[model samples]
Target: MKHSEEKEMIRDMARRVAEEQVRPLIASMEESDRFPEELVEIYGDLGLLQMWVPEEYGGPGGDLTSVCLAKEEIGKVSLAASTLCANNSIGLILPLLEFGSEAQKRRYLTESAKGRIVTSVAITEPESGSDVASLRTMARRDGDSYVINGQKSWITFAKQSAYMLVFARTAEGKGYEGISTFIVDCKTPGLKIGKAEHKMGRHGAPSYQVSFEDMRVDADCLLGPEGSGFKSCMRILDLNRPTVGASSLGLAQGAMDQAMRYASDRKQFGKPIAAFQAIQFKIADMAMKIGSARALLYDVAAELDSGDMSRLTLLSSMAKCYCTDVAMEVAIEAVQVHGSYGYSTEYPVERFMRDAKLNQILEGTNEIHRLIIARELFGRR
Candidate 1:
């Protein structure tokens, strides 16, 4: 698979931005647990924020593979900065690009590309967890508007987004059949943004719990069609899962890069740590794991771009689960290679460890992914 010139340019640009801007803000943002608002503006200016959007909708018209390339380069410097791209490509902007109405695209996608607004997706609830069908959010029709009532938890960028793609029950029934999707203005009445969550890492990207009480939107706000929310949800994951996997791939590669540099530069017993066979083995293993994960993730991304959904679901799960696990393992090894400095905030490996842990839990837990893969293997679609 040869890389495109556009993708190469995007990767180089992301790397330069991360090195010059995002990495400089990492320490300050993490200390304050505040999202890096300035860096996001920079990303928007570079068109990285809307790379997932099509050209017709006012974006760079890049594919998932290009987005992954950009993410890997940025993650090498700052995981939180890379997340800004992930949030857009995976579910937020991609969904609208895929299913939004012409009017919706013209307004939302165009503005999103211009950096006029930030967006989020609200699906996970407190009780529902990974059970998308068990969601308790209800949107009752009232004349030309729908009144929504529910709470969404662990919503990425909820506190900062100007709009959110909300999934709620629109009819009385069991499972996913009654669900629907809506694009709600965050300023809508009765929509309350909760406090930013204090997390283990990636503090530069914040998450929150959002409560919708009597939040009302016009009928025009509905995305796709009524009772089609569940299908849209599946489609969203199918499209962006490869990007999630790539995020983990980037984190692992970043940790490996840092560890390798430290090993070659730092000395132990009056000699460079790189000279020790034990340290050499760690570097070798880290490189191998990172390479393997990148291959799997990019293969899946290529399939995504090819419009061949045949085994994408299985491959995406494999990429997300395997790459994230490798990220955690490699990050820990990175810490081990650096000894005490790795455990401290002085080195970014500790942050990498924390961010990599979140990847496994979000975008469907690894346990659930295993179930999906097993189901696919058992001939149960």
Candidate 2:
């Protein structure tokens, strides 16, 4: 089969799994505000947990485009699940793939590819969410090992993951150059798992605070060269940003699907709401936004896969900002089309609306994305 054919096949399978297995649990998971470990295991079973891992490691060795396609389908049903699936392709996985020692790769990526473990990354601190240069986490070299001490907030899958990719300060310096990355086992001593946060949306997946007090690890745990982690993190983000846009695009598409069904079934004055020009226009606009955002998202994904960094930074920010913004707009319009029913839990539009809001905030705020895009266009003048 051609690449596109194979991609579509994976997408169809994801949709079937979502409809058959995930849809039944969405309501209960949303009500309870609990992460769905079963659903995550389903992803592992489907080989999505290692979708990006190289074939040498017993993975599919797929590209960012394939990852985005999978995310788009899973996100259509549950953003929480999509977020979990995306973690495997983003922050932790890429750095390890590029810079990890052969032993480190065989130890971590191999198990992850086999679905024997889940993973996460710890980079966002309480004080240094996006201003990574100001992170206060300290990792002091202690003779063949590093003693790490710090706290990380808003970490997803921290409790569920077996390992975490941690970034900390290894030298006294002003900005990103002093940072280093480490692969720390979650079971390490001096590591504390804090309370899970009750977030507004993606209720099926919980974020948490993680604290490391005198957490020590062998020098082999170091992922890359000393003081080069900031660049690694940025590289990871550049690669994953388009996948985030794909998730948002999926949410918008899902909202539109619900709206169309509701509009067709709902009737007023002896006619379906779909007959009304106002409803027609809204649906038309929703489709247009989704189409446009998808184009940019896939374009950026291809560029990222091609390893052309020249235009990727700017293009990725455009996709993340525009696509997520479209998601918010389309979700709200979906709710509007459904009227009071949309606000009610009976309809999925309200949930989509709530979920859409987060895409704008996480993976770097759309505002920050706009700034990045602008800076790229105008330069530092």
Question: Measured by TM-score, how close is model 2 to the native structure?
Answer: 0.96
> Could you estimate the TM-score for every candidate?
0.96, 0.96
Runs off by more than 4 Å, candidate 1: none
What range of 10 consecutive residues in model 2 has the weakest lDDT sum?
Answer: 84-93
lDDT of candidate 2 vs native?
0.86
Model 1 C-alpha lDDT versus the unseen true structure: 0.84
Expressed as tens digits, the lDDT of each residue in 1-381 for candidate 2 is 124888888888778877887778898879987777886678888877778888898777888888888888888988777777746766456878878888888877777787556678899999997788999999999999999999999988889888888999999864889999998888999889999888888887778999999999999999889998898888778778888888888899999999999999999999999999999999999999999898888888877788787887898889989999999999999999999999999888999999999889877888899999999999835
- The per-residue C-alpha lDDT of model 1 at residue 327 equals 89
Global lDDT of each model? 0.84, 0.86
